[model samples]
Target chain A: MDDLNLLRDLGRALDREPPATLVRQRSRLAQARPRRRRPGPLVIAAAALATAALVLVPALLRQSGKAPATHRPGTVKAVNLLLVGADGVRGDARADSIVLVHLPADRRRVTVVSLPRDVEAPAACPGATTGGRLSGTIPNRSLTCVTRNVEALTHVRVDHVAILAYAGLVEMVDAVGGVEVMLPRAVDDPASGLKLSAGRHLVRGRPALAYARARHGLGDGSDLDRVKRQQALMAALAKAAREKITNPVTLARLVNAVTSGMVADRALTPAFLKELATSLERTDPATARYKIAPVVPDPRDPARLVLDEKRAEALFRTLR
Target chain B: MTAPPAVPETASDADLIRRSHDDPEAFAALFDRYAPMLYRYVARRLGPDPAEDLVGDTFLAAFGRRDRYDLDRADARPWLFGIVTKLVARHHRDEAARYRALRRTPAGAVHDDPADAVAAAVTAAAVRPRLAGALEALPRRDRDVLLLVAWADLNYAETAEALGIPVGTVRSRLNRARRKVRAALGDTDPTREEA
Candidate 1:
């Protein structure tokens, strides 16, 4: 053999990894890039004020088709709430966690489907999937955009959105008195401040916050792992919170935490939240299924993600 | 006269880097073109874990410094590879340990160098494992130059460009690298003593 044969052996060894990985990394880099900050305190304040007004209202007003369709009982038919967890709101914001908590007409099951952030814009051009080439608008209005994308992607209209910054998540976890989470592996990411060794961890408060917010220090360090972690934490939080919602003290604590740091659309009222909570309280937490929106590489743009139409439709139907 | 249909303009890497100054999105095309090959190259040297972070950082670094990129160089391959080479250099211990581990460890999982199973040809099997050993034995710089040529398939001039060394230095380094590898192997390579 020649000196070159060692290289050939090494190349074949390295090349064993699937090409999907490159596509995923490219899609992630494209979709999850931090946006540049634009000076807009006035706009943020105004939006915050509007959100405050929404929070104060007893019931949200909506006409049939004009409203984002939800299935909430009492005031609405179904409740579709987008729980957005981002580091901050104003500048260069991306929702590190987006979970669409869908309460069906029956309201027996709480389906929290976590959409993979790497869902490339369908209209993205070649090479647009990596940098500021296209879709810069997606990051700033992450909750708004992702909810809309989820609606389009799943044929499930998202009616309410709650943007919970890290502070709110900490409070919420504490309010429910934390949750028990079994690690798929030992997570030790110092980036997002998560450093738990793998085991059944009774995560709460700051550690719980770290667990949910951690985007690194896990398997493959893909956003997919974070998505899975977020889903698992959400389910655990829900299960824990379900037992305590009947207690006035705990409920009041949750309200305080949620109102302070949680930004929401005007439609999500305290009454609606109570009603939604009551509905989900009876259901088995095990029944709360989570899904990352099924995706396929765009035939036209290889790096970009598009809805896996058939499987996605099936998933939505099954969840619905 | 009727205008002929306009063909879409395909931007070269240097052209894209130049254009990216105005339109940052133009850089993704370069990433799509090279990141996989870059990942594989790094993965072979370091392993998968570091390769993921290093490869991502390499692109970000390339994008960060895109404006300062040498426009005279049309291809981004050498430039991208050079950035990753610097990153791999930072993990001197892990990189050294990797070569040592490959020497002592049995194959699979951590150090799965694909044995030349199909390419036995009733000939080159004996030669390749020795080459792996010789690779382990060489000094870091010579190993880098040899691997940059042999592994990355860069031309001698491109290897010189990637490593920021003179063309003559690349020649001497590669020759020195291969001589040591061949010497370590002794009579395994039929053309062994030519060096």
Candidate 2:
């Protein structure tokens, strides 16, 4: 026999049948939440509020013959909005990305702080005394848990909360006709099936999402690297929305897309969203600051991160 | 709302994967279809201990990534195998060690059906150690190409898809690997009857 056939024989000799059933694995699959879910009605209401802020605010101001105001004195001084990018079904969802959007009183500077999903934080769920992963608290108490834990961690009151499914993020990007991202080097992440050559490329909805989600074959292959990429993607999306959202048709499509994919708290009324959008209108994407919360490897567990207490305190103090 | 159509036993992998987007349970069918073959292939590379978990992980990863799956591709073997192959690549040390051990240990008696016992015995006793040594010595990428074809029974196109490489690259790697194996066998010609 040829060498190939001989090698085949060797392979055969090594083969053994697996157990009849992978009970543990099957249970893991059944329990595990699948990603890319359609948003429910609550999300649509939230999306409408967000969309109203983006699309309707300008038209409303135009019709009222009032110039868009940068800030309304005697109103809310600052807003700390917690935006959670969740994966899987509504109630069982887990936070894949946690971003704190800190819009100061001036509304000129938009500072976004990305908290690593694996960051150690006090569990907001009852019956849990010990601290757990920041991402884990979401499924237990919904966004309320995440908001409380983040408030405790950052010492900034979360004024509003918006939960976005990955599907919604994709639709929002596509609605804006995609965003441009600069890749430092070529990426071929087989896990996410994201392939792109080094350079600046305008990626559509799916590729844009892939660029953000890819971690294994990009940068240092750490969650920190992914955080940086997500920040860039967010900045790019902001820039795209600012530049490309011009015509009413595009605006309507964007509204439809965003509303279908996101849910916001009842406190985030349409009027509040409108004011938030107006304040952020002049906020230059270039001036927008993006930061990852200061973190150090947990002394007890290298895999998890504990906030750099001193630096984190200093950072959160600035936002407050 | 109307209920989803019943999943036929003969449903193509692509159909099941597309359905899995709406019904996560549909993914279990994919796991059942591919896990055994994946287990066997992974076991051949890294032994049986880690095989089960790796196969499970492959399915889980695929489940999470069902959105990105190309529905146009009818068969998911390449995609599924590709996922398992990437997982296996992480255990390169274990795979290399397994081959080194195989090279050192002598092949024992041929426990097989009576019909092919003579050919199996000749091939097993004489050629296994050399083949294992060649496999260990070959470059990682080349070995991946060679083994996917010889062991996993994937065609060139499927192997190319699995490794995320061009079909031409697959051909070249397979040729290079075969040449090394030939060199390792030297003039022994295990296929020839012994004097």
Candidate 3:
């Protein structure tokens, strides 16, 4: 056949089987939504209120975390940050979720640590990990373990920690429309209703949040299982942010939503967030690698586990 | 005076870029118009299915980055061809795979008479594989300029406009791309070389 005929035939076949089949809502239609046409004064006041909320919320949350000594004099070199999330609403207690961030000394590599919830370790705080002092909450235990382990292993200092809640995660997901994920195994949990087939899926705001939190529904039913899920979801989120939504206006809206009710270490600022966005924009999804912290079965107790310090340290060192 | 038959609504490359920036559905119109021509060029060098996907993706990406449009240029062929050139290079294996797939299928009867069929097939057999390999091996810039002119039928000025390069650059690149293709095809005749 001639080249034109060959192309026509192939186009027909491809038309029969398109790569993407999802129904996407039109962007212009969304933009065309009704407006109240507020007066200039009211519009200005609303803008001011939104700006104040963005600045105050994160600042207030940062103050709640343990204030590490700011600005340790060193070659302004690569920094590793441990961002922890706690379940508790109060300010006095420790964090629950832990993400060990390793910024390469050359600023080329960024590795993250996701500590499992049930891994037993010596309580770092007077009663944080064991919840012996503060009602022994799960979030408290997780926070204590992360802080102690981070300080013990790597010479790289924990630059700052940000404690984000389920609400914060949901709002962020909603702001980004939804996040896409790949599940190696099926999830059939009644509680979360996270019935996913073994393949790719587009998890929307609420479902995506549930997927990150659902521990009991996955294979081998443990917090360890959930940690892996969280890392995969984070990678997928990064990919979607890079490929599907790279516009500044979309990013600013996302920042507004995520930073709306967030708590952070006083050290992380809006300037830092802007810088992070710029770095993130240049990066392609194919280059990023996400792995959970390695763990070994506890020698003392069969039911418990601990961080493989030697292996974990090696992993963190590479991040440097 | 009776109005002449209405010509179909067609936008210049600059107009298409502006429309693409404002409306994606309007941009899809450009894809539908040019994808066939683009696909045919690719299919001749590669095969069919790979060409289709590559052509679609080229238009999709071009549409997505419509804001980067150089509105001064009236034709988008060079930019579109540039994307196709990159994609084809990246998926060289896929093109080979397509050839293998084509080989397995029965060769359909050529449109000419029995005598011409044999001659045409004989010519195609000698020309097709060498052409494919040589086309694939050309430097990306030269290949882009050559195919945009030879297959997409772009003039030197239009090719330069599409590629965001000077007309002299287009002429030089086309010369280089043709010389390489000719060398691969084993055409040592002085007349063919001059052409």
Candidate 4:
């Protein structure tokens, strides 16, 4: 027999099941690892302080999504947050990126489901079936529309929503001294103003904005590919966020970036952000799952997106 | 919408390690994915009883050092097998004894060795008994390179990566090891490159 064939038989030599089982080791390990640590008194106090800081600046808290959120202490359950980055920070701008973060009851896993903005999600829209692309921006109450449509699709109750403009993306990236992203290939897309050589890049400000928005130049130019790149960038951002939490200057800058640029629900105050940052700091950056909401082309118009039922349900089941 | 509905892309093994870093419990999934294969590899060297505990320990060790994991390489098989190989080395007496038993036994069956299963299939495989002996006789590094490629089915590059040696070293060690094995079996292939 040739060397390769001999090796194949040799591999099969050890293929039989061992008399003992290693399956129980998983539970054994589960017991060893502690359950999620609850937010302690100091953490609570710090969160409260942070919340007070954000609340102190009432001018930043523009009531955009819905009526102000009535403050309440949260139980140890999953918190769903809707974070949208729009193209134009100040005016009525389309959503460039929409991500929903699901922090499990254990707060161990952070599942991020990114809604593709390029698709026409008509079913998500109240009346117009052709305009799901305008998901986070419709009429005066864009976040409500985005929240309502997301609820209809995933059955996930969004507890908090943060709408960030393009500038916010730049500020957040810069706040952490810039985020590093691994590019599979060099991107040179003038459409999204993304022009970088293929390699790891420390993106900040304008480049970061381009990195998030340069869907036109990267990865077959599909919205789905863009969703993946954004997820990687977000994971890097999350890693950076965890690292910066200990440094007061970066932490303050992060808080400032959120307060000044983001129009979030009243529930997403500085206290909430502090609690979240602390909770997520313990999380493994890799355990965070990124999913693009499943979509199929509309039969009548190819540009529109109709939620793919079976797959969409499967994606929601994990969060539910 | 012209796009496919949801293509649930499977997360790479490296990605799993990255996710497990923040959440210690996330390591369970990685254990579930790899423990069985690791157990087999361990069992082949040492018997099943020790294999069980070592497999568990390997995962625990892996979990402890997950933060140092390189996210660039998606397939973590080489890294994992490398860990298993080192753990197997600690049982040198057991491995040497198994090879001695195989050398003496007519059909090359060592207790719980899983060699008989392969021996039964290969025609006139009188050479396996000697092969086991030759493997046991080899230098640890040379044996590691050979078995990783021959038994573990890792390619040259993968073997190098797993062993933290250069590909040239992997080739040279494999050649030297193969020559010794061929000598033990008394199989003459003078034309084959032994470099």
TM-score of each candidate structure, all chains considered together: 0.52, 0.57, 0.43, 0.45
User: lDDT tens string, model 1, B1-195?
Assistant: 012122224768888778767655566667767887898888778877778768778888877777788899988788888888888889877776777765654444332334443433233344545655777778888988887887788999898888899999999998998778767767645643343
- DockQ ranking from best to worst? 2, 4, 1, 3
In candidate 4 the C-alpha lDDT for residue A161 amounts to: 73
Cα shift from native, residue A139, model 4 (Å) = 3.4
Better candidate by DockQ, 2 or 4:
2
Q: Measured against the native two-chain assembly using Cα atoms, what DockQ does each of the candidate structures obtain, in the order listed?
A: 0.12, 0.24, 0.01, 0.12
Indicate the docking level reached by candidate 1: incorrect
Q: Local distance difference test, per candidate? A: 0.63, 0.77, 0.54, 0.65
Candidate whose TM-score is highest: 2
- Predicted candidate 4 versus true structure: per-residue lDDT over A182-279, tens digit per residue: 87788776455566899998888667766766666577877778788888777777667656655668767876665555555556555666555544
* TM-score, cand. 3: 0.43
Off by over 4 Å in 3: A1-76, A88-96, A127-146, A153-155, A184-186, A270-286, B1-195
Q: Is candidate 2 or candidate 3 better by TM-score?
A: 2
Error of 4 at A161 (Å): 1.3
Best by lDDT: 2
Per-residue lDDT of model 2, residues A19-89, tens digit only: 64443455456546544444464665576444432334444455457777745554657887788887544
**Decreasing TM-score order of the candidates:** 2, 1, 4, 3
Docking class of 2: acceptable
Each candidate: fraction of true contacts kept? 0.23, 0.55, 0.00, 0.28
How would you encode candidate 3's per-residue C-alpha lDDT over A1-320 as one tens digit per residue?
Answer: 33322222322222222212100112111122222221232222222121121232223223346442233334235555665554433324344456666544333345667766556545454434453221134443234345555565444577655555545556666666688877778876544536688788887866786687676557566767777777776666555544433455655665555554345554555555433323322223345457766788779776666778888777766765
Most accurate candidate by DockQ: 2
What is the alpha-carbon RMSD of candidate 2 to the true structure?
12.9
- Consecutive 10-residue window with the lowest summed lDDT within model 4 chain A: A50-59
Can you list the residue pairs that collide in candidate 1? A70-A78, A71-A77, A71-A78, A71-A79, A72-A76, A72-A77, A72-A78, A72-A79, A133-B25
